[model samples]
Target chain A: DQQVKQNSPSLSVQEGRISILNCDYTNSMFDYFLWYKKYPAEGPTFLISISSIKDKNEDGRFTVFLNKSAKHLSLHIVPSQPGDSAVYFCAASKGSNYQLIWGAGTKLIIKP
Target chain B: EPEVTQTPSHQVTQMGQEVILRCVPISNHLYFYWYRQILGQKVEFLVSFYNNEISEKSEIFDDQFSVERPDGSNFTLKIRSTKLEDSAMYFCASSEDRGQGHQPQHFGDGTRLSIL
Candidate 1:
């Protein structure tokens, strides 16, 4: 199922620059959207999430913007550091449902 | 901080052999889940358990697959017969509550299962 899609396979950013990763979903029932960061050989770590009722949520250098009408969301990492280099996955879930529709991750690389 | 724990970081077994992956969810968490990620593939949800019963399951969770909370703290997933396609990293996760606003699930490092 291609419900969620991250069109960018990879992204490169200079240290201290901004990295914006985009994701789109086809399912309107998805009320919760989350971003996860994963490193090699490890499980995904939750980064941030945005509910459909809200348009934006931010935590430190990371910010998630949700456009429910457009069925799109984006994760912005400001002052990107080398530690931020990893695969970022976008996931969406319907209310009260445990299943999360995941998108093909976008690999982010930070250059010094 | 409390975190989910999973045993057998890596396992290699012959095809058709049964394999059981174990997990211990967070102490105060009430919802348990099992998800898998094949190499180069997106994470896929297998099943979710709440109150000792399966609340929801995905198409991938078939008769060959079963989940149980044998004890108070442990949640386990069993594959009756393994196939080559079953080789993947199985992850266990838990949440404080389900469908109660924005409760994000915390995940374990995962157990990598390999079918030979």
Candidate 2:
């Protein structure tokens, strides 16, 4: 079974526009969530994240909002730039040190 | 500025051959992990190690796979007998702290293993 899912395989947005990527999870045991951006042939780079106790967390151009009741979360990028083009993965873990349950990932294309 | 480092950016091995992938995690990190992503698929967890022992492993990690921290700084994954299905990008990750649901794991560029 897919514990975490990113139904949308890909997303595209214009430069300077707001882009949103969504993810969902079935495991209620998950207590922490994270987003990672990956470029081809490179390891994934850590993005923003939110604790289960908090609904939202923001850093610079990235903001992650979690709706625990809905078992869903979204990452929002303000004024998205071409450099933001990459595959974004959503992962969840139940404990602070538990294994990560990853989503299939969403490829974001920021059109210049 | 510490980052996980994986050797042999790409490897191609024949079926039934044994292969070992190596990684050097951050100096101060106490936790290490191995994850793999098949072509066009989500990354999946294989195992996590801490204090020179395995802390957790997933269903995908079977008898054919083994992990070892032979030295103070090197972590290695060995596949006793490789199979075609083992082709994928293997990533190494590490975390300074051990908080299951909270801390971020830094990853290496990954070694793309191509089993023939």
Candidate 3:
């Protein structure tokens, strides 16, 4: 079920530049959204999250913007570094449910 | 920082053989989960465990699959009869709580299961 989608299979950004990754969801019941970063062999590492109640949430160099009306969300990484190169996943949950619906990941490559 | 951990970085099992995957969730976390990802697919949720019982499970979690918290520290997933399609990377996760304002679930470096 394509409940969540990350249209871009890969993204490239220059070092010290900004990187934007987008995600869209078709489920209206989803109220929580999260962005996770994963290395080749490691599991996903939680980066940032936004609740439907808010439009934005920021953490250090990472920021997540949510547009509920359009059912879209994006993750922005400012001053991207080589260490930021990894696959990113967008996940969503509905109400108090613990099950997370995931999107096909986007591979972000930060060039030096 | 506390993090979830899984045993046996990779496993190879014969078809129809039973295999069990083990995980140790973060201490103090009340919720635990199991998810799997095939080579070219999105990570799919299998089941969520809370208070020593399953709170929710997906359609993929059929009669062949079972989850158990046999001890205070370990959560396990057992597949009664393995198939070629069962080969995938299995991940374990834990969250401090669940609700409208829920905490993020932390994952471990997954265990790769290969059915031969």
Highest lDDT: which candidate? 3
Q: What DockQ does each prediction reach against the true complex?
A: 0.66, 0.74, 0.74
The best candidate in terms of DockQ: 3
Model 1 residue runs over 4 Å out of place are none
> What's the TM for model 3?
0.98
- TM-score against truth, every candidate: 0.97, 0.97, 0.98
Candidate fnat values, all: 0.55, 0.78, 0.71
Ranked by lDDT from best down, the candidates are: 3, 2, 1
| RMSD of each candidate relative to the true structure | 1.1, 1.3, 1.0
Model 2 lDDT per residue over B38-95, tens place: 9977899999998778999999999999999999999999998999999999999988
Clashing pairs in 2: A95-B100, A95-B101, A96-B99, A96-B100, A96-B101, A97-B99, A97-B100, A98-B100
lDDT of 2 by residue, A19-89 (tens): 99999999999998999999988999999878899999999999999999999999999989999999999
Alpha-carbon deviation at A109 in model 1, angstroms: 0.5
| TM-score, prediction 2 | 0.97
Q: Higher DockQ: candidate 1 or 3? A: 3
Position B96, candidate 3: lDDT: 80
